[model samples]
Target: FYSELLHIIGLVETKVGGKRLIERNSEGQRHSGTILEDTIIHLDSLDKISRLSKAFIYGETHEERLFNVALGLNITWINRILFLKLLEAQLITYHKGDKSYAFLNLNRIREYDDLNRLFFQVLAVKHEIRNDDVKKLFEKVPYLNSSLFEPTEIEHQTLFISNLKDEKTIPALSNTVLKDEQGKKRTGSLSTLAYLFEFLNAYDFSSEGSEAIQEENKTLINASVLGLIFEKINGYKDGSFFTPGMITMYMCRETLRKTVVQKFNDLKGWSCVEFDELYNKIEDKKEANEIVNSIKICDPAVGSGHFLVSALNELIAIKSDLKILQDKDGKLLKFYDVEVENDEMIVTDEEGHLFEYNPK
Candidate 1:
C-alpha cells in the first residue's frame, strides 16, 4: 500500500497527530531510534516512501527555520513575493499546519479570481495551475461577482449543495412561508420564473422604461435575463465561462450607473433631502415597527447570496420609501404599498398564463 493509504489505515502510522518521528544515526553509521515503542530496526532502503519510512520523515518544518534557510534575501524574497501576490488577491487563508508551516489552497484561490481564466489555465497546464496563480487571480474579483460566477450550473450547484448538505437552503419565500411561525420549517420551491416576476411587475411590463424590451417580446426579455443568470451559474456551450466578477460588477455598475447611482446623485442638495424626507413622511410611521417589518431578501444560488439578495434588499428599501410617501398622502392603506411578503399572483383580466410549482 502507499504511504498515505497505510497511514490512513493505521497499518504503520506516519504523522502522529501532525508530528513525525525523529531518527538519527548513533555514530553516523547506523539507525539509532526504535520504529515503535519497543521495536528497533536497521535501515535497509534509504529512499523508500513507506508509511514506516514516512514516520521518520517530517513534513515542511517551522517557518523560522524555513526563513533561516531563505535568508540573505534570496529564496525568502521569492517566497515573500509569492505570498504578497496571494495577499493582494486575498487568496491566502489559514492552512492546516503549524503557523511556521502553513498550508494554502491554491485551487480554491484560482477558482475565486476568474473561474473561466483559471479553468483555461488549469486545462492548459494539465488541470493544475501554480498555487500563486490561483491566489493572485481571485483577489482581483469582487466578492459578489466572484460568488455569482459558477463555471457550470450543475458542477457549481453540486459544489454548493455539497457545502450545504446539512444546512437548510432557501430561495425566496412564499406567502405561506412568510406567515409561518418563527423557528418553524418554512418550505417553498425555487423557480426560474420567479426571476422575471418582480422585474416584469416593477415596470408594469410596459415599453416606456425598458424600451430595449418590447411588450410582445416579454418572453424573450425574460429568457435573456434568466438565461444570463443561468449561464453565470453554469457555463455557455463549448465550456466557456462567465467574465471575472470584478469586471462583471464594473460593467453592471457602468451600464446601470445613470439609472441607479447617478440618478440618486442628481437628486442632490436640500431638494433631494426634502424629497427623501417627504418620501418618508408616514403619519403613523413607528420606527420600531418599520424596522421589524423590514423586507426580506433571498438568492437561489445564495453562494453567499450576493446579486439576488442585494437587488432584493435595494428594491425593498425603495419600496419602503415609497410606502412612506403613500402614507403621508393618505394612501397608507397597507403598511407598505406592496406586500411582497404576501405577494399572491391573481390572474386578472388576462388568460392562458397559469401558475405552476417549480423547484429550481
Candidate 2:
C-alpha cells in the first residue's frame, strides 16, 4: 500500500510539475483545479501520503479502493521514468522490466531501532545525555566526512566532541548490549554505528525559509515535535516536555525588545509593533547593531538549545536587516562585513557567530 501510494504521488507530481493531487471532500467529490489554482492546497504532503496509504489499507469497499487507485492513474505521464528516479532517490529499489519495487535500505530501519535501544541504555546508565552531548557525539563520529556542514562549524563541533569527558565511551556505546522487545540480548554492531552516523548527517535541524522568523520558528516546532514523539515512544511519564518554539521566540523577542527600548529610549510606539518593524524605525544603524550585539541571552533549561539557538538567529537577523538598511542609504556599519560566495551571502559579524549558514 505504501509503495503504491509513493508511485501514485510520484506520478501525479511529475504530471503536474511537482504538485500533489488534490484530495476528495467528505461527500466523495474529488477536488478540482491545479494545486496552485485551488482555493486551498494541502501543505502536509506527508499526511496526504499517509491518508492515501490508509485508504487502500482499510477502505470500506472495493469501489473506495478503486477510487484511490484511479486517482493515481489519472495523470498523463510524459516522463515515464520519473517515478523510478524518485524511487531511487528515496533509497527504494525499482525493477524497470518487471515493474517490481522494494525498499533498498532495510538496514536504515534497523539503524533507527538500534538508536532507540541505545538511547534507553544510555538513559539507564547516565540518567540522560544532554542534547548538546548527543550533538557532540555526532560531531566526533568520523563517518560524516561529507561536506554537509561548513568547515569551521564542523571543526568546532569536532573539537567540542573531542573535549567531552565521556568521549572515550563512544566505541563502547556501539558495543553495548541490551535486551530487545522480546527480552533477547542485543548488541549494536559496527553497521549500526555506520547507519546512526548516516542518519545524523541526513537529518537537518536548520531553517530553510526566506523569512527568518517564520523559518526559525518552523524549525523549532519541527524539533520540538520530534522530541515529543520520542518522549511518547519511550513512555516518559515525568511530565517533562519541550518548550514550544513560538513561546521561546516570543520570550526572547520581548526580552530583547524591552532591553532595546529601555536603553535607546529614542524609539517610540515599540509596545505595539513587531521586532522587525521596531528595528527598521531606528535611524542609528550603528547603535542598533550595537544594541543587538550587547544583549546577552541565556536559557537555563536549554533543552536542545532551542531558545539560545533561536535567540542567536534572531540577533543575526536583526544585524543583517540593519546592515541592509545601512547599505541602501549609503552608510557604513562598523560591526559586520558581508561576503558573497557562490551566490550566497556570508555575514561575518562580532566575535562569536552562532551556527553556519549553508543555503540550499
Quick one: best TM-score, which candidate?
Answer: 2
Q: After aligning candidate 2 to the native by TM-score, how far in Å is the CA of 38 from where it should be?
A: 54
Give every collision pair in model 1. Answer: 63-100, 89-139, 113-138, 152-234, 153-234
Model 1 weakest 10-residue run by lDDT:
34-43
**Alpha-carbon RMSD, candidate 1:** 23.5
Per-residue C-alpha lDDT of model 1 across residues 215-311, encoded as one tens digit per residue: 3333322212332333332221122233333443444333332233334434332233332453443344454224323434344443322344334
Where does candidate 2 clash, by residue pair?
none
Q: List, residue by residue over 205-275, the lDDT tens digit for candidate 2.
A: 23322234432122121334443333221222233455565776677666765665555554433453344
What number of backbone clashes does candidate 1 have, counting pairs of residues 3 or more apart or in separate chains? 5
Error of 2 at 250 (Å): 2.7
Off by over 4 Å in 1: 1-115, 118-146, 150-209, 212-219, 223-289, 292-322, 325-360
Quote each prediction's TM-score.
0.19, 0.31
Residue 256 in candidate 2, Cα distance off native in Å: 2.4
